[model samples]
Target: MKKPGRFLAPIVIAGITVGFLASAYKFVFSKSESSKQTTSQPQDSSNTSSSSKNSN
Candidate 1:
């Protein structure tokens, strides 16, 4: 029983670590992609606004 518990402990710890890393990577990747989209769209909008103001 004690030997089984010791073997199980490392497996459980490894699984938890992998899950945590995967979630963290996903969170960071999504945030960067969203930032890229927002950044690109804002530049276009800012240009349009500036052009409209000049036209007026």
Candidate 2:
């Protein structure tokens, strides 16, 4: 019915919006974390050396 479609429109829009916002949060946090690690290092990028992969 027309009424149901009107109600569904907002719900669909909200779901899409939440999905986009969640992805945005993930991307920003990941970039921030990478920068944080770089800044936290004792020396600058010039002194960097090769490292080995760890299993963890």
Candidate 3:
């Protein structure tokens, strides 16, 4: 029916939009989190080594 088609179009569009947004969000989130962990780990190790040297 014409009415069903009209309703279906918006639903399809919304589903596609949500899927695209979720994927983009996940991609960005993962990259940032991974980078943060990598960066933080080196800084933490350096700090610990410096502190140990100072104590000695």
Candidate 4:
């Protein structure tokens, strides 16, 4: 029987490269989102209190 061609190594390498790039992109966006959430959360809370007090 003929042996299977040895193409697996390059395919595995390409898969690993794509996986890392995808992870990096996901990490960047998630970190940005978390920072954005942290920054905006305080503003909303403070606005709510101000509007409540102003109604008195």
Candidate 1 RMSD to the real structure: 1.9
lDDT of 4 at 16: 100
Which run of 10 residues does model 3 get worst, by summed lDDT? 1-10
Question: TM-score of the candidate numbered 2?
Answer: 0.60
The 10 consecutive residues of candidate 1 with the worst lDDT sum are 1-10
Runs in model 3 lying further than 4 Å from the true structure: 1-4, 41-56
Q: Whose TM-score is higher: candidate 3's or candidate 4's? A: 4
lDDT of model number 4: 0.93
For model 2, the stretches where C-alpha displacement exceeds 4 angstroms are: 1-4, 40-56
lDDT of candidate 2 over 1-56, digit per residue (tens): 34567778889999999999999999999999999988868454434533322322
Q: Write the per-residue lDDT of candidate 3 for residues 5-53, one digit (tens) a residue.
A: 6768889999999999999999999999999999999999999999999
Top of the candidates by TM-score: 1
lDDT (C-alpha) at residue 28 in model 4: 100
How many clashing pairs does model 1 include?
A: 0
lDDT of 2: 0.78
Against the hidden reference, what TM-scores do the models get?
0.77, 0.60, 0.57, 0.62
- Root-mean-square deviation of every model: 1.9, 8.2, 3.6, 2.8
List candidate 1 segments past 4 Å from native: 1-4
| Residue pairs with clashing backbones, model 4 | none
